[model samples]
Target chain A: MRIVLVPGVPALLPSYASIEDPVADLRAACHHAVAELGPRVRVLASSPLGERVARHLLGAAGAEESEADPTGALVVANGSAKRTVKAPGHLDERAEAFDDDLRRALVQPLPAGLAGIDVDLAAELWADVGAMPALAELLTPGTTAEVDYDDAPYGVQYWVIRWS
Target chain B: MLELGRHTFADDATLMMAIVNRTPDSFYDKGATWAEDAAFERVAAVVEQGAEIVDIGGIKAAPGEEIGPAEEKARVVDFVARVREAYPDLAISVDTWRAEVGDAVCAAGADLLNDAWGGADPDLVDVAAAHGAAIVCTHTGGVTPRTRPFRIEYDDVVAAAIADTVAYAERALAAGVARESIVIDPAHDFGKHTFHSLELTRRLGEMVDTGWPVLVSLSNKDFVGEALGLPVGERLTGTLATTAICAWAGARIYRVHEVVETRQVVDMVATIAGRRPPQRAIRGLQ
Candidate 1:
């Protein structure tokens, strides 16, 4: 099954659109990765807002929500939002190490590492990872990961990754 | 879409019509650009400042020396040709009330005829149509050209303005001007007192509701100056405040001296009114 992961950056939502997009590169990567997740896909998101973002991206890619005999799964998750002082959650001394570990696990397709993420630390760092544990059950031994986007723009670590 | 001769703009687009006076005693600039080169420099500067149209005028609105048709043509015709040769895409509007000068400037590649005196010349619309140029139909309450308001009174200024300008627009349409090419203006302080101008500004939406694009010439005019009791040079703040109100009310064209400042105020107000998107908003969304 095809699987793609996109960031739950609020700027990606249409409600927050600007004339000159602030997250243009990130949005392009998200759209590119999401488009590969064929029609009639299920979305896994940590929060309602994350689900909304996933649906918006899916709708934009001409994909619809489905569960029966689904083509692929779209996961809305992101890294620490407190990587800098100007971040939404402000600077956290432990954020960089946390996002670094998350990045390594995502790019390496390490299901065990993703399953071992400390929920307490994730919450404290304002990271959305509640739905990520399901990724452990989906990633097989032969699965490969490709990072489409990786950045800490606006002090928020965002990644667009595809695993097949 | 607004078809201004060689250029076309979106219906929702807000335009800045920069005032470029060829006269020696225009009120705002005080003869600063009376010379041809100086006026041309003004055109280049306003264009760089992002003005979409330039309203070129040979005679000041206030009463002055009797500038006959020949003198008016001499002041604006060659200058219009010069600007037309330079900025091929710029919308050049000749601010004249004489049909003869309108013909001359339109022949010289002028795009719009800004009839600031409220259609004083009966044949001006014909000239605009013959040249395939747009026309700005202003409401002056029947006052003659070059005369200031002395004791003019209107029972309902906004209603009067809507009636006059819309009728003039229809007249232009009858005279073969395109429906999209005709624009209406509430000539502030043209034939009305300070109170009349203020009421027009406050209720400009009535004119906008006429289904015609509204052009407001409130840039440092006597009405704005009198509203804040400030002089011409100090009325930018008052003018911007009025401009914001008008923009919120959906006025399409702003005729002004300070193009940059007026454009900023209009854009900011349009954004606030949900007519335009924020240029690059990421503050809390990020």
Candidate 2:
């Protein structure tokens, strides 16, 4: 199975677009990673906003949403929003380490590690991991990971990654 | 499409028509760009400053030196042709009240005839139709060209402006001018005192409500100067303030001397009025 992970950024959706793109690089990375997914992909989003973002990216990538044995799976998630003073949720000292731990897990293709994510501490740090269980189940030991984008833009940690 | 001669714009587009004087005796420039080269330079500069159109005028509006048809043509016709060749994509408009001059400029590749005199020459509309050029129908309250208002009074200035300008617009339409190509201006200081001009500026939305595209030429004019008791050179602030109001009120075209400043004000006002999005909004949105 092929898997693509993208941050649930509302700005990546067309409805919240600005005349000058604020997340041009992030958007490009998300599209590139999503395009690598097969024509029919299953979307695992945490909320309506995440679903909307995933749907837009999937549509842009010329893919359709599917659930019955999809060729690939699209996972929508993000790290801490309070990583810095300018972040959406304001500064949180614990955000950096928490996001670093999540990043290490993702880069290692250790989706199982996501199952052990500290839900209470993640919420306290403004990290959105509602879909972690599903993502953890998808992640397996033998998969090779490719990180397309990794940065804390807008004080929100975002990752565009592909695992095969 | 908002057809201007050979050019067309989307209905929602806002245009900045920069004033480029070809006459040596224009009130604001004081013959600074009277020379052809200087006028051409103004065109280049304003185009660089993001002006969508340039209103080239041969005669000054404030009781200028006598410039007959032949003289007016001598001043602008060749310049219009040169501008047409140099900037083929730019919308070139000529400000004239004479149908003879209008015919001459349109033949020389002019796109729009800005009749600031409120259809002074009945033949101007026919000329615009023949050339397939746009026409700006201004409300001058029956004032003559190259003349200032002495004691012009309207029971309701805004109403009179709307009635006269819309009538002139309908006249142009009847004369075969394209419906979308017609624009209306209230002629702020042309046939109005400071109070009349202010009232028109404040009630400009009424003009916009006519469903006709509204053009405002309130750039450092006498009304702005009189309203703030400032001289012509110092009335930019007042001009931009009024510009913001007009833009917020839904004016589509701004005939301005300071293209950059007017564009900034119009863009900011449009953004504030929810007509336009910020160029790049990431402050809280990100």
Candidate 3:
């Protein structure tokens, strides 16, 4: 089984596209990460926007959603939106620490730590991690993870990670 | 594809035709670029401003000292060669109604003949065809070249413009000019009163509907000056307002003195009409 993580940015949608792409690097990262998910996949997204982005990407890559015993999974979630003063959440002192903790849990395949993430603190930091608990179910105690993308662009932390 | 000399543009692309006057008496600049070096500089500047074509004219549209073919060729031919040599990809257009001048400039590397006089010389289209050059066919209500309207009245000015310009386009087609190489202009204020010019600006979409790309030369013309009660120098605002309307109505080419301002207006209008996407739109889209 393969799993990839991506962010739900509205600019990735065709309806919101610009003549000159504002989020070109993010888009490329999303495309690369989504392409790793095989032909038949299941989507794990926290919000409707994330689901839409996942569906669009999957549709563009000629992949389809599978409910019964999928070959791969696409997880849509992102780090805190409050990493900087110009961040969407307008500067939270604890955002960097929160994202660092989440990054460690994913990179180390600490399934229990991911499952025990503080949902109340995530809300305060404007992090969209509701569907991350699903990753805990897919991951195991001793699995190797590859981090494909990690950045704080537009003051929002985004990561495209893969685990097998 | 819309072919302008060696350059070819897709059907939906909007173009800017910058005005580069070789005359010392043209209304707007009034001898500012009458010298050869100055005119060349103007060409370079407008190209930097994203102009797709340069309409170089020898004689001022308003009546001035007579400029026969010899003098007109002297004014534009070698200059066209210089510009073509420097900016090999830029489309060079000579604003001449005489076929002799057209042939000479085309031989000197001009890609278009901007017949602002509404095809006064019948053989101009033939010259354009022979050189594989594009032509701008304007409607002047049958008025003589360099002569303004004297009590010209039309039952419907827009109707007359469409009929005459479309007929002129057909004449070019019959003369073996490529179908994509011909464009039509209503020749605002050339042979019309203030009200007539205003009406043409309002109904420019009718001309666009003819399926031949429409070119509008409304840069600081008398129509805008008269309508706004402004002088020639201060009509940029009015000119841009009319340009926005025509752009919304699908005018494909703009002939203008101010290249940057006209390009901005056309782009903004195209975005509003849903024909163009924004350049880097991410205020709230991020």
Which candidate leads in DockQ?
1
Model 3 C-alpha lDDT per residue in residues B229-270, reported as the tens digit of each score: 999899999999999999999999999999999999999999
lDDT of 3 at A153: 75
Ranking by lDDT: 1, 2, 3
Q: Which wins on lDDT, candidate 1 or candidate 2? A: 1
Task: Report the error of model 1 at residue B96, Å.
Answer: 0.4
Residue-pair clash count for candidate 3: 0
Give the clashing residue pairs of candidate 3, or none.
Answer: none
Which tens-of-lDDT digit does each residue in B1-286 have in candidate 2? 7999999999889999999998887778889999999999999999999999999998888884688999999999999999999999999999999999999999999999999999989999999999999999999999878888998898999999999999999999999999989999999988899999999999999999999999999989998998899997898999999999999999999999999999999999888887787788777555
For residue B45, what is the lDDT in candidate 2?
99
TM accuracy, model 1: 0.99
State the DockQ of every prediction: 0.86, 0.60, 0.75
- Which number leads on TM-score? 1
lDDT digits (tens) for residues B1-286 of candidate 1: 9999989999999999999999999999999999999999999999999999999999999998999999999999999999999999899999999999999999999999999999899999999999999999999999888888888888899999999999999999999999999999998899999999999988998999999999999999888888889998999999999999999999999999999999999999999988888999988776
Query: What digit string (tens of lDDT, one per residue) describes model 1 on residues A65-104?
Result: 8888889999989999899999999999999999999988
Q: Distance from true position, residue A135, model 3, in Å?
A: 1.8
After superposition, the stretches of candidate 3 with alpha carbons farther than 4 Å from their true spots are none
* Candidate chain B TM-scores, in order: 0.99, 0.99, 0.99
